[model samples]
Target: MNDKSKSVKFFEQLSWGIWIWSFIALLCVSIYLSVWAPLGNIAALLVTGISFAGFYSLSIKMRTTTKIEGQMLISNKAKIDLKFIKSATALDAEGFKRLAGVDADPAAFLAINFWSKTGVKVELKDKKDPTPYWLISSKDPKRLVKALVKAQK
Candidate 1:
């Protein structure tokens, strides 16, 4: 859904697995109730449809989006200007685990999801800002890092 002008360099949605699992659980419950109460298949289908709509709304509330708009590094939780960033490191699954777990900074801005194992760690240059870095989850860490680096320049 991006235009040819390419103002946005990266975009990803986290926790899509929740959408799949929630729908399956709701459908199963609908079928189980149909077996016990003699409700027709049409009624079960209706219940399934209604549950899907509710779950869609809930997933939207839980989902986190990461995107770069112009020179801004943004997520559902927070956004920052690229000018304040010093460097961007693309982390693999293992590097991400270490930084997100054992080496995490208390003052860092975290826009991470457990389901996302690859990401970027953005070090901040602005001394006035208390935050040391930003930890962001991405489906493609390299692409995200590339975007952030380009924006910082």
Candidate 2:
């Protein structure tokens, strides 16, 4: 039987607050420019609208739920059930070599952001959910993969 405990990781809500604040700042800048700068009110409005849309997108992206259990990495939005992952296979030798160069372990798993370029991404077989699935980072990829493999059985 799989012995690993189930854990939930929710993205902090404070991140949403930050995005809201950024949007507000952008709006303020746009208003100021509209009143005092060469750009007309129409241009300012466009800039403000774009900034708001960008922040809105970021807010949506920041919200997510992660479930890690014996041999499975699940995301509620994506409805992904990644089964039978081997711990060693979680991070390949090349990834490990890269981490080693930075005094880091490839096994460590971290959440992915817009900036991250490396990590595993998987999609659920089901077609209901729209969010993409990921196994972005793992501190012990091999162990996690092994746990997943065992859980799948």
Candidate 3:
């Protein structure tokens, strides 16, 4: 019943929200050093290069990925088969806030990243698993839900 070519696959990469500004600040620091400090051209270039590399490494390390590969739904923190999913509901900002706060289930698997406020809640049907559902933060909840639903079928 499965066709690999037609199977729905979605991949999303989420970076730390403040990284861009931090990177810009790094560049500004290098400029300041080059202009104000009595440093050789090679020294300035080396400092800038090393700073950029360090910032880039930090950004990559902090990034998280959400992927739907064939029948599997993969998050940075967890993964589940689409067949085990019973339902998925897309959440807006208010709903996400409430469920993630007061109404949250302790047993739920949270793949929440604080940066993105919108998300999807996936309910599971697997009897063996104690976890009630998965709360995942997604930039595009509707599209993620649609992809999951399509893959499940």
Q: Where is model 2 more than 4 Å wrong at Cα?
A: 1-15, 19-36, 68-103, 112-153
lDDT of each residue in 1-153, candidate 1, tens digit only: 345334877788887685677766867686658754787677776776776677778767878899888777888858888888889999999999999999999999988886788889999989899999999888888988887777666
C-alpha RMSD of each candidate structure in angstroms: 4.0, 9.4, 3.4
> Which numbered prediction scores highest in TM-score against the true structure?
1
lDDT of 3 at 13: 83
- Per-residue CA lDDT of model 2 for 37-89, tens digit only, reads 77767776777677677767876767544445533465434333553232324
Q: In model 2, how many backbone clashes occur? A: 21
Model 1, position 72, has a per-residue lDDT of: 79
Report, for every candidate in turn, its global Cα lDDT versus the true structure.
Answer: 0.82, 0.48, 0.83
Q: In candidate 1, which residue pairs clash?
A: none
| Model 1 lowest lDDT segment of ten | 1-10
Is 1 or 3 the stronger prediction by TM-score? 1
- Give the number of the best model, judged by lDDT: 3
Against the true structure, candidate 2 reaches a TM-score of: 0.37
Model 3, 33-146: lDDT tens per residue? 874478766777777767777777887876777888877899885788888999999999999998899999999998887677889999999999999999988889999999
